[model samples]
Target: MEIKFGDAKYYAYTGTHDPASDLESVVFVHGAAMDHTVWAHQSRYFAYHGYNVFAVDLPAHQFSRGELLLSIERMAAWLNQVIDQTVGTAFHIVGHSMGALIALEAAANFNHPDAGLNSLSLIGFSYPMSVTPQLMDAAQHNPSEAYSMMTQWSHASAIGGEPVPGFWSAGMQLSMMENSTAGSVHTDLIACDNYAGGEAAFVKVTCPILFLSGMRDKMAPAKLAQAEADKNNNAAIVLLPDCGHSIMSESPDGVLNELKRFIGARK
Candidate 1:
């Protein structure tokens, strides 16, 4: 599923369309180092509900061809082009982790005229990028410790109550540290932690925003997400009772159910 665009190549997978009704389109964006496979659960669930689904591999990771620019701006630009090509005007954008930043860029930074998106649903994200210095320092100096913390924190006993299965641990580990030139993985962590635009660009976003968070999301922190969601005139914040950073994996059914209702309410 390679599509040549300018000098870059993007990998895309289309899930089965929803049978309930005709949907405009749905694009699922994955975070850093992760591929479209990350959305396997979400895509299948949503597509079955009667909507077109598109899961894409982000730049520098997986099936995509290009040196990792690692810039959210470039990420949005690439997504805009893809949308215009396939659906002419494209559709709603759903993003997680690093992909959330790209969605923000699409709604705020880039503002593609052909995006044709009516809404945005951002899960596991917080505005103003509160990726504190403590987290950043830990990620760079002690990646293993950081990884362990992620695993431990992902449990229901941690921040939120939802428990992440050990099944995803291997995938997450490999994605973060698989291929690299010595310190590239650490470098990626730094870039992600120090991502820009904070809250200014986000506040200007006019589209309806749906913010998802775990009651105790170690990364985004529930309180922070709620406050960010409050700034938007058309935003709704949902705290998955006992979820962690990876809300999709921690509570796939919860997310899908909420999305089903969200989609129903929109039209």
Candidate 2:
């Protein structure tokens, strides 16, 4: 479904039901060079099981319009707009990779008179998400090469675990990145690299946080994720064995179960 946030129209994957009438809403944010479909498995699950799901496509990504926000701060602002325009109040937030950083910023810094962030789930996240120079250069001059590097580093093995039979996870992710607007990958990489507010932002978070990491994650390893989790006294860290950075696709059931448990306890 498309909703108007200022002049920009945002696309959200609402699955079989709309969130217009639901009191409980969950917003899912995708990583850099990715779209709402990354939460396909979990969004559908929540939408039909008594919760409103807003799996959003970030600006200049897939079906969403407007130029890409180049910083985590701006992305958090966009997230606040999304919540205000849609649910209009408190809601649960889930984010992955770069999206996780955005969620953290939004939870810590964003303020809305009519709404508030209820809880946060950060999956495959890191504090100082430093992007390698080679990846940044590739994103600027050759996006295809950047996509290749991302695909390789985003999974546990060279051949990634698929969400379904005959559907290759790494290939699907590559296609999604390839479809992104020109220079978007570069902008996203720079955004993650330049973000310096993570530790500070995390310290200010008032809600319960769930930190989910993949033990085999090469991009954001379990140790790095645990370091971030350690700062939050209210955070519960779960490490999925054999999973990679793409936790939703690589270990959909595990991720969904953890989400169910976390959101259930809060609700």
Candidate 3:
């Protein structure tokens, strides 16, 4: 479904099998250069099992139309606008990678008072999400090379394991990056590198927070996420073995099971 938020058209996959009313809304935010399709399995599963799912395409990414927001704070604000325009109230939220950082900031600085958040799930995240200078330079000066480096680091192997069988997952990631605007990945990496609000955010989060970390993730490792998870009283951490940073794809069933249990308990 498409919804107008200012001049941009935001696309969300509402459950194809269910009605759009009386069900609690769950918004899924994708990582940098990625669209709502990353949550393909989880979103539909929740919607089919009785929930209103909003797996969103952020501005300037695949389906959403607008200039890229450039910073985590701005993206978080835009996400708030998305929630206000669509669900208009209390909702659960899930985010991956860069999206997880955005969700953390949003939960810390929630704008809606009367209709507060229910719970938050963050996948593949780390506080002060530092990026290597070599990668940053590649993203800025040589995007194609940066994309290549990203693909190399994203998957467990060159062929990847069963995220979307019969297709090259690493190649798929490279293709997906092409859908983003020029320098979008660079901007996202910069935003993640500059963000220092995780410590402040976790302390203020009043609702439940679940962190899913991949044991084999080369990008954002399990220990980094676990350290952040320890800061919050309501936070709990889960580690998935034999999984890479692309937990949603690398370990789709594991992610869904964790989400099912986390989201299910609140409902």
- Per-candidate TM-score against the hidden true structure: 0.80, 0.95, 0.93
> Could you list the CA RMSD of all candidates, in the order they appear?
4.0, 1.6, 1.9
- Full ranking by lDDT: 2, 3, 1
Q: Which candidate is the best by lDDT?
A: 2
Q: lDDT per model, in order?
A: 0.66, 0.87, 0.83
Clashing pairs in 3: none
RMSD of 3: 1.9
Q: Model 2, range 53-120, lDDT digits (tens) per residue? A: 88999898999998889899999998877777776346889999999999999888756666666789
Per-residue alpha-carbon lDDT of candidate 1 for residues 18-46, written as tens digits (9 for 90 to 100): 22223556778876545677677788876
Error of model 3, residue 264, in angstroms: 0.3
Q: Which ten residues in a row have the lowest lDDT in candidate 3?
A: 15-24
**Index of the highest-TM-score prediction:** 2
Per residue, candidate 3 scores C-alpha lDDT tens digits across 1-267 of: 887867768777887643355677888999877888889889989888878888888888887788888789899988888777665246888999999999988887777644678899999987778999999999899888888887778777675467555856566678888667887889888988998887887877889999998888888878888888887778889999877787887788899999999988988
User: Which stretches of model 3 miss by more than 4 angstroms?
Assistant: 17-19, 163-167
- Which residue pairs collide, candidate 1? 18-50, 18-51, 19-50, 128-198, 159-216, 160-216, 161-242, 162-242, 162-243
TM-score of 3: 0.93
